[model samples]
Target chain A: MMIKLETKSLREAYGLCLVELGKRNKNVVVLEADLGKSTRTVLFKEAFPDRFFEMGIAEQNMASTAAGFALAGKIPFYNSFAVFASGRAFDQIRNSICIPKLKVRICGSSCGLSDFGDGKTHQSVEDVAILRAIPNMTILSPADAVETVMMMEAMLDVDGPVYIRINRNDLPIVTPENEPYKIGKIWELRKGKDIAVFATGYMVKKALEAAEELSREGIEVRVLNVSTIKPLDTKAVISHSKGVKGIVTVEEHSVIGGLGSAIAEALRKEAHPPIEFIGIQDKFGTSAKNYEELLEAYGLTSKAIADAVRGMAGR
Target chain B: MEAEKVKELKKVALKLRSNVLEMVGVGKAGHLGGSSSLAEITAVLYFHKMRLNPKDPKDPKRDRFLLSKGHAVLIQYAALVELGYFPREELKKVKTLEGLLQGHPDMKTPGIEAVTGSLGQGLSIANGMALALRLEKNPARVYVIMGDGELSEGQLWEAAMASANFKVDNLVGIVDYNRIQATGPIKEVFDTGDIPAKWKSFGWHVIEIDGHDIPQIAKALDEAETVKGKPTVIIAHTVKGKGFSFAENSAAYHNAALTEELYKQAQEELRKQGELL
Candidate 1:
């Protein structure tokens, strides 16, 4: 009854996770805010109809309901868009889940311009910042389908409330099939010296590309993929950026309170290094015809990282 | 409920009331009126009703209690202290920095079930806890105390609907119908007339009683235990600042602090009622 991580699409990965959760744990429940199909938790409803709760578009109620389910000894994985999950249910997430430290995993897809065509109203670049502000909240922005599956499994092991931001777009598989995904640890994709490229969520892929582009210019860039945003791997971030002359942080989220800010805070405490942040600069993203255009508009591209790294390197 | 037990419970309730006022007086901060109104209900649940193991607050089989009207957490803290969850001396720690006692109920504290202060969210947490208990086939009841004014939150009804739909018989919701909210009378702010009827319409077994009546409150809870299907809602009519004269029925005390003179007046009033243990 092992449901392999069958789907590469983020939506499909969600469905697979729910189906696996239903088979293994009877206490595992799914809560949807009338966006079952969109969030891909409809798969759980199909499998364990009795355990699934359809809270009907009220994101706040859905969040607290998940907390209720957790109090009842059921592992509840809630699903909604990032905006609805974080914004519409900010108080609920803070008070009911984070403050109480409930074992609830909030699976918010379409984060950080994943809704390319949906524009500013749908894109949720602020979720990471908002969730990070709350104490005892674990935030994860998985890179691709593989990472999503890994985090979905990792969530069962981690105790307390977790916010797993999954991008709507399907990312190219980066981790080898056998590579174990550990929570609160960074993945050193490529080793280099002069500049360290710290990236998170979907930006990890762009970071790899940026590193390759910089390597051609003899500016050896080290790529570190940080999926776990909270309970951050401060040890790895500081160690990696230790001797590096310049550090470049990249994220699909706002420069405020996302990966860049987190890395800066850690760096500020340990050692001050010349750090250049390549992310959405304290502004909302516009609706573009496609995801690539949205990234370009926000300057969250490999070229942007490359330019930032080169600038910090004084090239 | 026997008269002696009823009298004992009333005494505990009054002590809890005094503790809440004392904490506010110490911290020089708190929701005085809301806490006073909720003291009796908190007393009935923590001291005499709910099955909680103070030694193991996270006991799986234990009944659950959530304070949805979390701003009045001073009342809950008072009950927790009197129930021996923590030392009675902790009463002085209210609103202090680096202390477990915060202005709002926080689950991080040893005995608190959920961190509640933002209105209209506690019942959902209780409902989830109750649903989980039922799924585990355990017979532990989950009690959630909400302010009457909190009914303005649509999620309360959503939780109510879900509880009855799931037939969560082990879930009990008690609304402290103190008739006053932050601004003024609840009727003037938002009238939720015939609350008992409203709960009944939502498919719950609704019971109406005086929130300050210890015997009636205990009896109503006992009656809920016999109900085979559906959840129960006890609309307990209460007086804001029940034992304190100056704060009573006054909306300003919802989160107001007592003056030194007022604190002495409140203590004198509690002494006169013979409720001081």
Candidate 2:
């Protein structure tokens, strides 16, 4: 089977989806912390001027204000860089939003070392781990642009707090456009019998590519898209690992308390194969000229994943 | 303000003080200083100024009051008990695992609009509610009370800038200017100089009044409602423990366990105040 090579920007898709959500629901409001242009929420600001709140550079205030909006029967989507959204305003999100369980959607754009030029200060490789520790928080990591739009639509129907991690660059469209996205469900992008590869966000595309590479070497590899990082689909994880030689977990984040840790915790009690984690190995990202350079430096490429699978297959 | 209404509100404030003592009990630690300081303001807002329904706490068109200085929640709980938001018996069970009330403001409580206790976040929540009400064309208003010492948090200034920038006229902020914190006085700790001047420069309609005076609190609230194009901040000058003889102006009583003698003495002071009224 041949895979399409088309690509689209997740940030641009998020902006367009906010405009559509605003039109569908009058109570849909957007809050930005002076990163509207970078996060693409300026599109929503242009469309619904009355509903858009420019909160300056104050992420803590923006978070609590979103809680207030939710209290008054409005669906608010607050945007900022992943580091500022999850790290700088963690307390506000914990006490004001998650503790009370308000209907506030937090969008952390340029997540997981995607903002390559800004270095460690702007990049967020631990957002999922930090947010997952808090109760009543639903974490969403869309595989591509199509899934970003679908997740935003699904967030409106969710009752409690949600944090959606979006990448900076245009990613290959991996998910189907017509299928409705569910909150705690995993999608199998490719199937095999020898090894199972669990991936999320930008890594899903890399996982698919790696599976195709392994297919040529007579080694079958299965690829699963674990989009919902929190409240993970453990049953699917366990069942997919069945009859496989080993499992490989991939993400654009740290190996600690992320998709890898989530899977490891899930299978600790159940009967499963050995697992290998592929991510930032507890190290800060450095300033790079481009995204591919950073991915290569961090060993987050199709070749690296294929090598891991081949090692698991004992080749 | 009518003299009869003033008398009635004063009685409500006195009752709130009595309720605070009951909630604190004789041995357990509670925020007596801040709770006592907010009694009159809480009474005036819940009984006279804000539009609310105890039976239907989630009414879409009702006014909102958030305790940004949530350690003073005993006074709000006292007012809520009187208004029948919860049972009066629950006052004795505050800060207990089986009770509806917690040490901080939680949404689990029937009348709490936001979960607060970590200081300096309530004003922003009030601003959000104000913005939402304006967009929906709802005539309801939002009120938040902050501690003077809570001004030490940088997030409070961030929220102040946001409320002004958004022109949230439907929101009103009150600072319990007791000038004392957990450790010591505001001047010795973190002094926010010239309170009214600070808020006025931030684009809020500034109002200063004696927090214990019922008529003054009522008049300031009425004045805040008429202001447009900006939010209002009423800096209510107050003593830390206004009603009690031993606890007045004392930071030691801020969150101390009352002795059996002090408990009886607090009740006696309230009784004498009631007789004078």
Candidate 3:
């Protein structure tokens, strides 16, 4: 029998969390680049009209302005589409925010292929890769609404600049609600000895599903949720990789510089099992009728992940 | 302004030039042209305008200044050194690995509001600070200096619109209109026509003045603080390499090593200017 799971919108959670954070901290301000409604920062605008800045389709200005706000002892969160946030305003984010080590939180909403209808122009597959190269940047990718709220809170305590990727859809509520979130600690959702699966963002749900599928086939698959991409928990990754027959790294980002590469770099110095990367194989996303169709077309489904594990497990 | 104050500020300007020469040293390329162009403006801001305490450089209520045209940072370093933000001895170690002063403005150095070597970014940061200060009901103001050639950056225009849209009256922007850039003349390279008109059309309170004139610089800054709803931009027309006769209006000196002979000549010129003041 197939068990049903509940889903929650990460954007909604983000909006509600911002309102709560605003009420608690008067210094918390929000800046948006004419995508408030889409990014859900509009909710913050309605609640704290005085603190919200309408930067008007200018991501570069918004990013640098957010740096200014940080310099003045305010915690500024600037939001834009992932492509523009990480690509168009890259120089501002690098020179103004990261280089100075400001207390600014950059929210790249609708990251990955979650914006399936918009196609390659709007989707951001290389944001992680591009941001990872910058110094003094903390990268976060939450799996579900619960994790999004947790990550948002955790971002407040971080001393330096942070980049958090948010998906466009309501994903499966996989992360536990009561558990406290740590910035760089890896979350192991399942215990197994046969195969290890490291996943992040919405792909964490897929990895859990793949684990269940592999379990029925008598393959014990371990699923690890890697929410923090930069300052990666390499110790946990190395410790978990030991004794497992093989490993499968999954993300909704480019396979080149995403979680797979991070895990590969972590285990390079240590003796570990062989690894398989399950992500977009160096391809831009195309328009699809729905999100699931794009995920399936790109071989990002549970079945494909299970197949990778099975192939690596030699079953 | 009193004659005594004017003479004092001109002397400060001359000292800033001398310090720039010291930092660049002989036979080592540095941003002598832009840095010299900003000598008078930096002298006025550091000595007359801008509330700063060297002991408490990060004072929350203190006025903020950012060099958007950060290549001209040698002048700012001179001002900071005079203000005792750091030891004057650090001037000799600029651009060195262990030096406190860098080739551009960095937060690692004292009293720098933001990292702003890359052009077109400092104005937006100033706007952000203005908005925050207004939100907090703080009376502190923000000032940013931009190069005329630096205005070619698209982000600068974006920030221009934002500052006016937000009505950042507490923020002031001064363009070091030296009319020269790294490669050549801004007019020949990439002319941004009608500079004053462009700023006025952007809804700023525009003021044009001789940047080297200390009294005019002080008056424009005073006028900016009284403007109620819009930000102000002072277009301070200046000569590139103002103090050094050999480098004046010459792009070659924009960032070039000063030979020992030329460096001595530059110092002698600044000393003469100081005597006249």
Candidate 4:
């Protein structure tokens, strides 16, 4: 199944979505912690200056304030870099937002290794891990611009707390522009019987590419895009894993407590074949000159994913 | 405030203390010292200061109250039951499985504004409510009661700075300055020296008051409404475990399961205090 690949950055998609939300809902407000320009929340700020809040580098304050706004009958979209949003304000998000199940949207921009040149401090490989530990938090990791926009559209109707992670650079559009978005539902892009590559975020596109490359060698890779990391589409993951010779999980995050770990946990009781995880090993990342170099250095490339799948498939 | 009103408020405060004691006994493991410290301030707000209707807890025009130091939620639970937010029977089932109340302030419990248990989070929430109220053009105000030791949490200072920067004049933060925390004195655990000056420097209208003094608590709240262009922080110098002699200023009672004998002693203390009031 071929889909037209449009080129649009996730950050740009986020900015446009905010403007769309601004026009549609008066109760929607956006808050940022002094990185609005980099995070692309400046678009929302310009359109809804009255509703936009510049929290000035205070991520923790932004989180609780968003919680407060939720209490006062307003849906708040609080934005920050992934590390700051998830790591710095974990307590606030956990206590104020998750515990109460407030209607707040926390978007962590430049997640994973997307902020490639900035080194490990800005990269948030553990954002999902930390947030997953908190109860009542729905984690949504959009694969591309289309999914990001759709996720933003879906956030308005989400009654509980949500964290939507976005990438910094342009990721090839994998999901169709007209594809209906559903939280915790897997999007199966390719059909195969030999192996299933469960991937998330930017790695979804990589998985698709790896599957395409593996088609030459007749590996018959089944690609599953695990968008909503938490409230994970476990049924989809398990059902697709049935009868497959092997399963390979790919992500731009730590293999310790990420999508790989979540899938492994879900499949623990069920009888399944061996699985291989292709992500950053348990090690700190250094400042990379480019994202491509970072991906290659971390073994987070299509070749590496294909290599893992080949090993899983015994070929 | 009139003398009769002050006397009546003190009587209500004593009743609230009794209610806290009863609730804590039911919950088995609850913050006795911290909850007792805020009884008078909580009583003053619910009975005399904040405009609230128990029947309409979600009233748009009603004032909002948030217990920032949420571990000390037993007293707030007491006041809520008295105000008819929930039936009195619910109070007896606190801390039990499937109970209406939990150890901390949860929105699941009626009349709770924000669910706060982790420290340094309530002020930012109050600031959010203040901004929302101002945006909606509602005349309602927000009241947040925090613990003294909770001030050491960096997020509170962030909220304090943001509140001042945003001019959240409709928000009033009352620090239950009981000095004593779970381990020991706040000065010993993590000293935030010069509490009033810290709040003042954060651009809040700082007011020092005897938090246990019902009339003075009422007066500080009244003064909060008159302040313009900034939020107000009432550094309420309260005694930890006020009205309960054995528990007063004792960190052991901060979050203790009262023995049957201690519970009886607490009831007697409240009984004697009620007579004095």
C-alpha lDDT values of all predictions: 0.84, 0.92, 0.92, 0.88
> Candidate 4 lDDT, tens digit per residue, A155-192?
78877999989899987888876666767788998998
Instruction: List per-candidate RMSD values in Å.
Output: 3.0, 2.3, 2.5, 2.4
Give model 4's clash tally: 1
Q: State the displacement of the C-alpha of residue B202, model 4, in Å, after optimal TM-score superposition.
A: 0.9
lDDT of 3 by residue, A47-114 (tens): 99999999999999999999999999999999998999999999999999999999999999999999
What stretches of model 4 exceed 4 Å from their correct place?
Answer: A1-7, B259-261
What is the Å distance of residue A22 in model 2 from its true position? 0.8
Model 2 over residues B1-277: C-alpha lDDT tens digits?
9999999999999999999999999999999999999999998999998899889999988899999998999989999999999998899899999899999999999989999999989998998999999998999999999999998888888999988888889999999999999888989877878888989998889999999998899999999999999889999999999999899998999999999999999999999999999
- Give the number of colliding residue pairs in candidate 3: 1
Candidate 2 pairs with clashing backbones: none
User: What is candidate 3's DockQ?
Assistant: 0.93
TM-score-better candidate, 1 vs 4: 4
Best model number under DockQ? 3
DockQ order, best first, reads 3, 2, 4, 1
Question: Please, what is the TM-score per model?
Answer: 0.90, 0.98, 0.98, 0.96
**What class would a CAPRI assessor give candidate 2's docking?**
high
Better of 3 and 4 by DockQ: 3
TM-score, model 1 to reference: 0.90
